[model samples]
Target: MLLDELVVTADAVASTRSRLAKVDALAELLRRLEPDEIAPAIGFLVGKPRQGRVGVGWRSVGAAMGQPADAATVTVAELDAMLDRLAATSGAGSAGGRSHELRELTARATEREQGFIARVLLGEMRTGALEGVLTDAIARAADRPGPVVRRAATLSGDLGETARLALTATEAELEAVGLVVGRPVLPMLAATASSAAAALETTGEASVEYKLDGARIQAHRVGDDVRIFTRNLADVTHRLPEVVEVVRGLPVHDVILDGETLSLDEDGVPRPFQETMSRFGADAARATLLHPWFFDVLHVDGRDLLDEPLATRLAELERIAAAYRIPGEVTTDPEVAERVSREALAAGQEGVVVKAIGSTYAAGRRGSSWIKVKPVHTYDLVVLACEWGSGRRTGWLSNLHLGALDPTGEFGEPGGYVMVGKTFKGLTDALLKWQTEYFPQIEQRRTENTVWVEPTTVVEIAIDGVQASTRYPGGIALRFARVKRYRDDKRPEEADTIQTLRGLLRM
Candidate 1:
């Protein structure tokens, strides 16, 4: 209920690694929560406001603790004073009044309260800390044994929802929110069915559809309003004005659609992935190339397709999509999926996604019932001091020098030396455009011929074979490893580590 309560728990959790100590700490923290703290805690774990189609980033703790949003616009000292005022108010008497008063204050605060808003929302209230660190601390404070929190984390769908349930419900209630016996808050998935004969073996009568090759896009439509988001949940409504406009005109009152967005070439065939991605970013030119291809409908006129089996949902979807004569989505027989996949691949499209006859829509998850079988490639390599590039890479040294990790004397920051290859490829033209614009943010310096860099980028190279080399480190070289592409989602530490390189070399 008060700021000190949460702070005390955080402090106690951070102080220990002992099991008994953590359980004791959690017990002490629990005493302070007063039940009502569950709402704010839920809000905290969710990273944004009330559940929405696409979420905003985490808001500050100061705001959550009842400080006016405007309070964030004030001086650090002023913010501190506001925190102090709430703390004192909580102790004095009228907790509800303080909450009400804080809400009123937030309404009247300055329009330009940027720092304060960031500080409060991100819980940047304490330095040298992050959500993981705090959650870990809470488990420790609870006096639980090693990884008690992590164990709890894995049991529930995710940490935030788990934490919220833990604070508000019984253990049975907690279990109720899980997949085993619970009604999932998000989407439900259908079990994978085999061939129609195999389907008869499993369910007597299974439903199936021809697998499709395209980007997975989930469309959520509420009333007259429609929102489009990616699998990872980032909103892409603006990039898809043509799409949202199409979905809106559908006769359904409210619905959720699952499908992909791709581009077709002159022959009316799907385009390459690189060409499709170009139509989404801010600097994108008009995308006459990219087009929407709807496959299945998840919801329709006041109905949710989550728990229903695939066969039933498909029948409903066909009625809805056909009613609107949706142009992009094409329904086909399951037996023809492999042939269709080859057709799409020949057209430069990704592989296909197979669906069963009685499948359910799986939201916020990578459901097994709906599997994506893409042709993926991987490589392992050691690190070498990187070379600097030009323009955007003029500073902070962006390029990398790759090597094979030596087993006997593996890599240790310039330890082994190999010269297998160098590459400035794998990046799309859109990515190149971004690097050119934002490279200055990380640049360190520049030289006449060789540029020095930050050594942060990592990439995969798809090559023919391995070969022995005199110039490169590790005594061997990648025969024709070319830059496949920059792995933007990974961190440098996670880059093919030295150990991974040894495995590749062994092969």
Candidate 2:
């Protein structure tokens, strides 16, 4: 299929606020793709190239832009091949090779196709066709049940492969996709609650486990081999050998453990989040060893526990990895929940995650089955833009323009971020220097004082609370907002929503 067809469909999807209309438009486009073209086309529509992050930057893409072709002639397969070449370009003189290839690819694309390609390369496609909507569209195009497709996608952790199976393979083949011991499945997520008591109300008879200030990890072990993946599914087995040894010591021959890993001080108190993250991102294991604490066991000895209730899974976790299990207790009482929350905080932990005992694991979905409560009001927000610093902080990107996701277009465009407020507080000199150097690399456009960027950076912000405001499109402004930290473990789409902030008006 021609690339223009996909681009036009994406344009239509972005132009409409009605989610049904967007899904229909995407489904129509998906129906026309050849079997081999489905994955690459899906990647383009979602702004992530199947090749992953090619070494191309915004400046590199801009330098390659030239006169566009008058007509659309580029095929989906051809574009995929070009991206493959771009991803493979790396070495001493790879920069020139990448530039030449990008120019050649852009020369064959029309103006519309060129713009779309640039956005895809820059990871800036804001076309409202989020994964949920596209998953529904794939189901519609394949004439498959939505739940079946969703299950397969979640299990495999690859929507492109799921689309191929749904469209080209038989129903039985698609249904056969299950949790593999080695492959990383999407981690179960938690919604926010004001307090442990409030969270208990949402999840009755819950396991209120300690919420750690650490990196999320999913460890898969088969025999003696172990692979660790981050929240984004990036493999980091080599960076955390201590964690691997800890998982290898488990009695089970094969297991999948969901948990957190963090470096602790001599007293066993968790270190600062940044220090833990620094060790987590290292190229090799550092002297500061990270300890793994398993909270839920998804698989054990060939038994799939994902379909099991939390009570059952916790039983399995206790049986196999009790020594490493995070501290918590099962309780339904509000006072007990509050006490657990207090204990966790006193231990220097983040807070508590109250999980419903009877609820099965819902991978990748933030249902009310699990709710997290922190002492302070903190949220993961997106960095929409950054302003140049002044006075003592001159030349640095000091003030961050924060935004919340508006998934339903209640406050603005669907799948777009609504600016809620700005903050220059809580940043250290080191952070300011890093921001000054990093923000320009991802710049989409810039005014004299502000540099607009792709809404991809997630930062955790703490606030006193939110108050109704007319200055922002979301009709809410953060009160005394300050940066907690930059959430490198999260994605832009995973940021808290505008509706969530608006709901705070009630508090």
Candidate 3:
């Protein structure tokens, strides 16, 4: 996997206009790799590292390519320079020596060094294809199951690894895909847990304990050395020394806890969301910005509680925080929970996340496992079909044609969904490419280009208010049904119905 190899693949994927063809080509190229080769392969395709979740902007790529005004132009020397720099530090020493090291890598016919070096400098890799589509393509190429590919992807946090392993796999693989699957992820910051009922019914359990919010953090501690990672998994332990101090002082030594980092104002209320996000990745200024309130511990000692229920984890979390008592806070009462959550809201916090005592930690997956009940009426709709978007969406599949389940099997169309409106936000060009290709599969074409899907996706849609429209197939249409995200876990069967829409409208 030399730089040239990746460049060739990048050129192929980016230049190909047909989404299905792009997917097929990528799948074939990826299918030839070993399990260990996937990450670098993706890095090559994207022209960056697969490890970090960072996105590389064309501006930076342009800088690397020395294409001052040109946005799309990508070059190998810009990529080579990045690899040379990484080799200088992580490989050989000094600029002159680094070139020699890269030359040696080329001579050995190794793409690892070149890929890693490029990743180190490029920050991210960009290709027209997306993670999910690539996962599907990998599944098809490797002849493995889709769930297996998905599991590997979740565990590794790298889809390229999934693509790589698809080439050749064994019964006992390199990484166990279990832990990452059911790991708890924040659904969406809520205003409050309005009911113990919402938590229990949605999670299908008893004794839902409400957790307070400051900042959402997934803190991982390996040993005596403690490192705190944010929701996105970028380690910021150094930034929040005070938090590290709290974590270090805890009774439990080795564990991965999910909690929030809050910055209290002089009046003891939470700061604004913008103020909190500003504290992210800030090492020196973090002392003045934050503190942690541990709500649950997913893993402790040698045991992994990814399979353990949520209630059990929270008990241990409360006990540990209580003994250490460094910036400690925990609660089981819904009333107190409501107060804190409301306090958070008053102090500009988003809301509280309530968990069933028995819920499992589901990572990268949402829907009912941890139900988000907000004060507003919101529905997670899918981008069923799309129109060529406007302005910024020019030349891109710009406007997303939104839909809900055509549950009634109405108008001689049953078991599929229909279009209601189109949205232009929350999409990148790659996402558009995906829609253009896949959206047509379930597409019920009544007209040219503006196709329909089976409503197999879900998005968290909100409106300032709802409107009444009998003409629209949903009977009532959303005033503004914008896409929040393309939730992969949710199936089309879960899409909002005409009844649900009308219910909200009536309310």
TM-score per prediction, in order, is: 0.45, 0.76, 0.57
Report clash pairs, candidate 2: none
Best by lDDT: 2
lDDT of every model, 2 decimals: 0.48, 0.91, 0.56
Find the candidate with the highest TM-score and give its number. 2
Q: Candidate 3's error at 40, in angstroms?
A: 2.1
- lDDT (Cα, tens digit) per residue for candidate 2, span 1-507: 999998888888877668999999999888999999999988888887789888989889999999999999999999999999999989999999999999998999999999999988998887888888999999999999999998898888888889999999999999999999999988889999999999998888999999997999999999999999998787899999999999999899999999999999999988766578889999964789899998998999989999999999999999998999999999989999999999998887889999999999888777899999986789999999999975346678999999999999887789999999999999998899999999999999999999999899999999866766779988888977999899999999999999998886654
| lDDT measured at residue 331 in model 1 versus the true structure, 0 to 100 | 34
Q: After superposition, how far is residue 175 of candidate 1 from its true place, in Å?
A: 12
Off by over 4 Å in 1: 1-166, 169-215, 272-275, 281-290, 322-337, 378-382, 385-507
CA error at residue 312 for candidate 1, angstroms: 1.5
Error of 2 at 301 (Å): 0.9
Tens digits of per-residue lDDT, candidate 3, 1-507, equal: 334455555556666667787778877767655455566566555544543433333343233332122122323344444453544344334444544443443333334333333444455444566565677777778777777776666555556555655666652473455443223232222223345444544444333333443467776665567877766555677788877878877776677777777677888665543355567656556445586876667678767776688667767776777542223124455455556555544544444455555667665555455543334456767666667643234455557666766677763277566555556755667777876677767766635546555556677776433454546666555654555667788877887765566565433
